[model samples]
Target: MSFTIYLRCFNGIVLREALRFVHQKERFFSALVRPLVWLGIFAAGFRSVLGVSIIPPYETYIPYEVYIAPGLIAMIQLFNGMQSSLSMVYDREMGSMKTMLVSPIPRWFLLISKLLAGVFVSILQVYAFLVIASLWDIIPPISGYITILPALIISGLMLGSLGMFLSSAIKQLENFAGVMNFVIFPMFFASSALYPLWKIEETSEWLYYVCFYNPFTYAVESIRFSLYSQINIEYSIGIVIFTFIFLFLSILGYDPGRGNLQKKGGK
Candidate 1:
């Protein structure tokens, strides 16, 4: 009811999510493995063929590994977001979600708390990846590391909100895997994550358009620019806009009075 109560609610939610992440060692490792594999193996293989031209974020020609590093970071946040949604669906089936939803705190606050909790976990994963990448010589400027935090936060929220909205459409935990694959793969591959938008354009115009419109592309670009201590205002604004849009949809979907919660027979 008061400010302190709201603070405690947020702290409790964040702490719970952090503890869950700490206990799930496999979750941490799995999150790193996918991006690491691409960084170590795939990036190495393509280093010669995929030489990157000077982009706004980079003042000079850079290696393929360097160019894709931000994309991999975005990938970590993207997967972390979906993982959060999977937990939401799990909680729903276990009936724990209903208890939280019925609490005195506002529903939107509760959902945003959960979203922030997931973002906290995601920032951890992204930093861990950065540490490993640095060891492998993919380091950015020291200042770049500091400047990138805000970008990561915005990107994480947008992706996590998307996952929350997707969870509302999924009635069962089992169906999530299929849906995740359908969404994740296309979002990753179609975006400018692995290749530059220009390269995609050279290959196919329609695919280039897909990359142009994908929010994930903006997420990656925002990170890429931020890591170099530059702000891609256009991409950053796009990410913020999508974050709000997805957050609104997630709040709508989780509303017991009018959202998917009602369809699920939630009280």
Candidate 2:
């Protein structure tokens, strides 16, 4: 009975998110544009200069655009997460969050449903980006597409949970746009998303450690490995750990008894 209720709640939340996505047509293209622009501009500039090592799983030398494609895929998920988090902030301000909190479901279940909804929306945007990349001749192995599905879901949920936790932590903020700017860009750029960890390490030891420690790096590397039909064991484990940590933080922050949500002037 509890499982049934949870399933129904999950379905309803995903449906609502899907409907919202259908209405926001601009968001679809906007998600696509951001990465493509980065890919186009960076690939054009760095194609000749950056030498990609013969990394395991990636059999041969690949073009710069192809190398960054997984990162861009992860990028779309990261931005989608921030947007979803912003929506949560808006919901709280509008009093809708109160209604959600008052529901019969467990708060953790609600959080999971919310995370899944965001993941679903983000995955749709990801495939659209992939389709465009393929059209641009940045194709992957056809099997890679099949294998990437699970990777996308795991990566999407990790990023979405991080955003959700961030929203809950800053529940008092009248404007959460700053979180979007401050959180998203740093996580994206500081990771293995754009450049190899080795390359970044060569430039700065501290920065390499930053990238290594960044959960986003694991998320991106996990996706990159999946794209080539290989599993990055260490990074994959890192993503799971980070996801659970963020999930626990999210649950705590939204708990009014323990968290800032119901406290006046709390951060």
The residue-by-residue lDDT of candidate 2 on 168-208, one tens digit each, is: 87745565767867888898889988789999989999999
Cα RMSD (Å) per model? 1.1, 1.8
Which residue pairs overlap in candidate 2's backbone?
none
Q: List, residue by residue over 1-267, the lDDT tens digit for candidate 1.
A: 899999999999999999999999999999999999999999999888876788777888888899899999999999999999998999988888888888999999999999999999999999999999996689899998999999999999999999999988787789888966898999999998999999999999999999999999999999999998999899999999999999999999998778997787652
**Which 10 successive residues of model 2 have the least lDDT summed?**
258-267
Q: Evaluated with TM-score, which candidate comes out highest?
A: 1
